[model samples]
Target: MLTGADGRYHWPLPPATYTLTAHCPEDGSGGGTGEVTGVVVTDGRESTADITVE
Candidate 1:
């Protein structure tokens, strides 16, 4: 999924622990990748994970 202009993305998944990763392609300038591991999501609750790519 792609993030909006604010660099925010939304994805719904079944309640469980997961590891998420995000990557930005290098277009000559620069690019990087980030990952968030051991994320927990519960029913009727919201989980937030902030990843910063270098």
Candidate 2:
């Protein structure tokens, strides 16, 4: 997991619109793959997001 400027856990991906996703660490939780979230950031702009680990 990655920490953002927002002080939240997330995954930093390529700067661009993406189908951001997060999944369980195979801890046998049905919450595998976090809720679908999306963010549209320019190639050279700032972007951030927070995701909850089930």
Candidate 3:
């Protein structure tokens, strides 16, 4: 989990399929959610999964 003032994050993991989800709170009610699925991370490379909640 990530928490702070910055809206950026990063993670390093082994080669595999992964899923990333991001959520943002709105007002005082329920929040919004975004997800990125089937992210294939390979060896000796960089993979990006950007999620935006609006």
Candidate 4:
């Protein structure tokens, strides 16, 4: 999934562990790849994960 113009993304997933990844290509702009492992999503709650590309 891609993020909006506000640089934010969301996904509705079942309660479980997950890995989130983000990638930016070298299109003359900033380019990098970031990932977050072991993300925990729970029932009746919102989970937030942040990946910093370098």
Candidate 5:
């Protein structure tokens, strides 16, 4: 889990297809959640997945 003000995270993963999910807890105002699937990570390469909630 990420525990900072920047709201950034990193994970070491092997070369394969994967799925990433993020969840925001419910507050008095509101809450949201998001996910990304089919993420491909290759050896000696960089992969990116973006999730946004509103």
Candidate 6:
């Protein structure tokens, strides 16, 4: 996790291709899943989608 000034997670990923997905791991939170496809490298060059988990 990228730390913000408050030490909070600002961004969840780094430069790389990924199958970005989100799901509630908790039982009561409910089960859900989503995918973001073809997320290409997006850093070090105008910050163009170098970090994604879709």
Candidate 3 deviant stretches above 4 angstroms: 3-6, 26-30
Is candidate 2 or 5 superior in lDDT? 5
What lDDT does candidate 1 reach at residue 16?
A: 99
What's the count of clashing pairs in each model shown?
A: 0, 2, 0, 0, 0, 11
**TM-score of each candidate?**
0.87, 0.47, 0.66, 0.83, 0.72, 0.38
Clashing pairs in 5: none
Top candidate by TM-score:
1
Task: Report the C-alpha lDDT of model 4 over 1-54, residue by residue, as the tens digit.
Answer: 889998898889999999988898788876899999999999989999988887
Q: Compared with the true structure, what per-residue lDDT tens digits does model 1 show for residues 1-54?
A: 989999998898899999989998898868889999999999889899998876
- Local accuracy of candidate 3 as per-residue lDDT tens digits, 1-54: 674577767677899999887888777867889988999999889897778775
lDDT of 4 at 24: 88
Which candidate, 1 or 4, has the higher TM-score? Answer: 1
Flag regions of model 6 displaced more than 4 Å.
1-14, 26-29, 45-54
**Which sections of candidate 4 miss by over 4 Å?**
none
lDDT of 6 by residue, 9-51 (tens): 3344567776645443456656555456676656663322322
Which ten residues in a row are the worst by lDDT in model 6?
45-54
Q: Residue-wise lDDT of candidate 2 within 1-54, one digit each (tens)?
A: 645575466444566666566665565565555555577767666676555656
Q: What would the TM-score be for candidate 5 when compared with the true structure?
A: 0.72
lDDT of 5 by residue, 1-54 (tens): 752576767777899999888888889658887888999999988888887755
Runs with alpha carbons beyond 4 Å of true place in candidate 2: 1-15, 28-31
Reference-based lDDT, each prediction: 0.91, 0.60, 0.81, 0.90, 0.81, 0.48
Q: Considering TM-score, where higher is better, how would the candidates rank from best to worst?
A: 1, 4, 5, 3, 2, 6
